[model samples]
Target: MELGVGWTLKPVGFEDEEDGQDAKKIVDNQFEKMDYHGTIMELGMFYRVLGRACQVNTYDLNGDFYFNKNEKVTGADSINPMTITDASLRKVMADRTGTEPYVQRVTGSVGNPGTVELEQDRVIYITNNPFAKYSTYGNSDLNNSVTDLRTLARFPHYRDALARLYSQMHRIVTIDSENSYNIIW
Candidate 1:
């Protein structure tokens, strides 16, 4: 089954540009901005799931108290940094015949391998299960569900939240960078 993840950002306040001189200061400030934004997005996703299961406010869904004051307001504290040590993406894969499930595979090819290439550098297949089949009714229901969810999750809310959180980070960059700041989920 596919899992749902949701995310949001918190408001961030930064010092004025007049107090800038050192490159270290600028880099540090930028890093702080990234950490804050990343954390909030992560925490928001976590809270979305927890709030649904426990029927509580998203803000109050933090069970480990990882989001106390002094912790980065962003959701980074919700996850263990070590879990994402490598830049590679991670996912779960289930075993079809056996009860044992395993983490998904990670592989990349040096060049294009056509339909019948056998001597590939890296070949990884984490599962043997066939893809899930969807009936026409199921497909329609899924489409409607997605449409309803997206409608409920207004784009303006995410935009406004991010705008408020990284107001200073946004100012430091150019218009092109600002355009790039737009994140969907």
Candidate 2:
């Protein structure tokens, strides 16, 4: 682990980031891992700010009202949530502006802990697997389409705050300066 014969060896015991954890654990681990010497009031405030950030910016770039939105993102909590019949759904996801670039840009990026379930298709199903409960998936446009646009209002936000929270967490971790600590607020 040489660094051009200059800097000392990088610190060991870096935290392994996990997804879909309970809020208490998330905040506790986040605080502990940051090596912060703050009061619970400060920690609570941080959580509040982070929570609000997730809620507000979650839909910041949500683009449009379409027939099929909140597309079920499979393979999250299941081994094989997507059947072969839904292969086309994966492609449709890839074709979408919201998900396509994320897949491509993050495809081989090292230490990238994010996940995208579909590789291709354009269908929406309300049926939720443990992993893709929030995603839309199916093989037919009719099955995917609906009259209420708001129900399908996920647009670019994936219909929830998880994505925004993840992005915000990345910011907090990467730029944890004394001043940066309050950036989320």
lDDT of 2: 0.31
Error of 2 at 135 (Å): 19
Candidate 2: worst 10 consecutive residues by lDDT? 51-60
Best by TM-score: 1
Give lDDT tens digits, candidate 2, residues 56-168: 10111354212212442111111122232244335443454545321221223477654444322222223323355334342322332343234546564554554455455
lDDT of 1: 0.32
Per-model TM-score on C-alpha atoms: 0.19, 0.14
In the range 35-119, model 1's lDDT, one tens digit per residue, is 6444445444443432211011113354421233464333223342222212121211222333332222223375643222211
lDDT of 1 at 176: 30
The number of clashing residue pairs in each candidate reads 7, 17
On the 0 to 100 scale, the lDDT of residue 127 in model 2 is 32
